[model samples]
Target chain A: MNKTGRPQDLPLSNPRADRVRDVAKLAGRPARLKRGHFLVEGPQAVREALKLHQERLAGGEPGVVTEVFASEACLDRYPEFEDLAEGTNARLATDEVLAAMADTVNPQGIIAVCRFVDVSLDTVLDAGPRLIAVLCQVRDPGNAGTVLRAADSAGADAVVLTASSVDIYNPKAVRSTAGSLFHLPVVLGADAAELAAACRARGIGILAADGYGSLNLDALQDENARRRLTGAGPASAFDLGAPTAWLFGNEAQGLSAGELDLADHRVAVPIYGAAESLNLGTAATVCLYASARSQQEPAHGETTHE
Target chain B: MNKTGRPQDLPLSNPRADRVRDVAKLAGRPARLKRGHFLVEGPQAVREALKLHQERLAGGEPGVVTEVFASEACLDRYPEFEDLAEGTNARLATDEVLAAMADTVNPQGIIAVCRFVDVSLDTVLDAGPRLIAVLCQVRDPGNAGTVLRAADSAGADAVVLTASSVDIYNPKAVRSTAGSLFHLPVVLGADAAELAAACRARGIGILAADGYGSLNLDALQDENARRRLTGAGPASAFDLGAPTAWLFGNEAQGLSAGELDLADHRVAVPIYGAAESLNLGTAATVCLYASARSQQEPAHGETTHE
Candidate 1:
């Protein structure tokens, strides 16, 4: 046995190992989540955790990873584990034990237990961010993950989850994010008032997308018109002040009346067809992409080839 | 029992009942689906099946309802069952029996066995003369449903799914439509070339949404613009030609090269953020809504509070 009391032998597979597997599943619960602990399954999530760990190390912070496990074969596959070996307490377990710990059908052969970092609204602003997405009461795991993935792709600073939003660390949500959860700062359980205050303090314009909103998103794309619209910056630039928060609501009931009332402006995507509303995740992507379009310079080079 | 020679009385809490349920499950298989048969469960889907039957009756077409079963209380609550009694056979079963036949938990107290309507591309065009969503290969059920629901909300004439697309009648797809599937013409397994040819014959411009396309969606929305954006109507009026097909593709692969080649013009939603792409459903919704916006007349009158 190793000093930590776990077997040092290359794969610990036994009936007693069930307790260890149960510990990984505990990460799915809210209580464990609140305790700042999460289980990273498979090599993909663990590799991402290690990447983040390295970034933190370079930035002069203690590595965030607490524990890591793999079979001897996994260790053999990744022999150059300089930083990982030094920082993380590694354990060798059997393939059966790893599979038992994994939530997915195909395990990636590596798992890590890590501490969740608290990303405050200030951290997002400090990251030199320009755009952010605020999800209000979005309960579906798939939608939440898609939004996170979209936010990361849009180069948004962070994804702020308002009260009642699905947990970011939910295995399904994490899986859906396709590794974007690691790349982006995800703030959960934030209150609307907190979000509003943070945006207000950051000089960020809060644009709420309501179906009834008078402002057409297309009109906002007009470079000269948008400058005239907001009465700020050059005609070619989008000047919604320092930062911008695009607020999205639940899939069924969109942004509430109270939330709409707090927005500096209300916007709507013009619809010609019979759809009552766009899906919540899709709407956020469109809105975020629209904002990005409004702010960026026109692209050069061959756009599309035949 | 009802002269069909099939078992009319379902035995609840019996091992044999499980086999009957298994038989019902087999009804959703592709062979059965291709043969124009599908199982309906819960009150909503069953109610929709009945309504479709009624519409067929009123239209002088052969009603495709094969079987209907309900608890005594369900029959009493619905009451309007003259056609159900006259045209198709009906059976009264215990709640447990009904549950055994049903696919969902808390079954809405009803179930139906109905023939799927093989809605043809020509029939879809004949029904409506204008807008259409021609899905190239949307493989996600949720995305397909969202597009269909969006098409319905946009008051689209029809939603045509090409080969390789997800089954529109998949329970998840149906649920995602939020009942819009029942109202709209959702024709599945269409040939892309045939659809493009049909739309061309109708003078409907085929606008494909390509991320790398040269034409911007906003540019198309402008009245003075000369180059036509795919899936868009003429600038002067909201009336998009005779009919238009908005082609969307798979979530990951997007529109195929051959599919893009068939389009009248490739159009794109400009992105300012880092997201490599929008989710398929979001892309379709945005483009579809953009087309809808282009067709909308200026809203007038005092905006009523909701």
Candidate 2:
């Protein structure tokens, strides 16, 4: 915005403009990889991208967003974007232009071009995270994003996607995150075996979410509760309150034998009804929240000690 | 060959036949409503539909599946389908014919036209269910289906979709259920207030899932656990272990004030991370699973009796 806090220029009316094409190309992998940038569309995601960008700029780090295109109505509806997009190259654009530049038919009249936000796995692990979610070969963009959003809601310290997983920067994936993509640290394209080893060395137990696993997730959590509340139960097979990383598998095949082998234990979210099995997102939400609740619940240490 | 249990005759090759068009029309609401039927696509869903049909027929009840269409390859791949489809009006079709009759790009070689399976709210409550999930104005078909599948996984006795909620028979919704639709009783087009009152009359407590509610789901679950383990705690705001119905709202706007007013208590699935709120399916899954676990936990009331 200019000194008056108005959009910088006349609305970009040409949908075929070189700038519009450049922005749209970020929707695909080739351009994104070449330019090291991805698209963040709609008000929620754009708002989050701008917030993170502003936060980084304030912290003396390089900003996350490079450019933002928003229609005047979007600016009017969400005035916070003005301040959030202050340091970025924010521009006024027509709906036609915005639509052309967005992967989603409805970009909610706003879009942001952002630098890839994934951090190195080492950076995430270095923070001593107590809760992490690892996705193994999850191919659906929407499923990946849903799991990430669930992870964020569960207060997971980080989210890691293995090499064969769908790109979280894929526009649908970003949209599916509902803006949680910017809320937590995400590590993409890491090797599952290496991740498991590093986590193991750090004492973060890896629990594979499998349908036919020997250990029941609810039973484990109940055991944890029994220990926390009564202090009379035998030592549980697994302490859910301890540091942990949960391994989630693909939408179809689930964790492979090799992938399951890397985990300390294979745990199944018990299906109470005949569901065959839980969807990846549902299973992940249940498992992550179980760990979150166990780790975060208030300790009645007196009962445990006696 | 008929006695030998082979696919009856030549495969359907004409994609433009009247039968094909009639079957394909089920993808739209008008067609489904007119015929009082809906499409169940994909192997898993078709298998579930066939199983339910077989079970119903065995019980001298009207079968759920009205007609079945599959490619010979699909039947060959899933041999159990032969027995499952034994009494149904099963027909073999070419891939082209199957695609023409399917809503999905790839129906995975099978689709079934099944009668609308939703029952009355009174029927559901008459079962004396221990747990139920009620969807209020949930618009997205996938979201509705995901919640239903999650509810099924949680072993919820039934699911109720209030009037104006997305039609669960929408192909996307049916596909999202991933066979869980056949596993549980569902009530659609339910009046929220009336349903709430019915549940109340049945001694079932209503809990609305709200992001800003006063009651925290985790806290309530913890209190239940403490009481279950220690047999001593203040009387909880609500007993999660009791017969209960959870109200889930729309994807974007949560429960309206009027809708929230229908519940005995409004509970927030704790947002332990920076997420603005949990997605409807995630929140529903967490809430329903919490109730499921509390209700399903083995009773150890020796401490409570004292």
Best by lDDT: 2
lDDT (Cα, 0-100) at B9 in candidate 2: 82
Backbone clash total for model 1 is 22
TM-score of chain A as modeled in candidate 2: 0.96
User: Candidate 2, residues A94-163: lDDT per residue as tens digits?
Assistant: 9999999999999989999999999999999999999999999999999999999999999999999999
Worst 10 residues of 2 chain B by lDDT: B297-306
**Alpha-carbon TM-score of each model against the true structure:** 0.72, 0.97
Tens digit of lDDT per residue, candidate 1, span A1-306? 123323255566652465565646645776455667766776656766777787888899877677777776766665544345455777777777777776666556677777775488677767766788998988888899888878776668788998788877776777667667777787888888777887787778888987788876655554333243323333533343336898888877889988887788888865555345666776777677666544442321012211
Pairing residues by index, what is the TM-score of model 2? 0.97
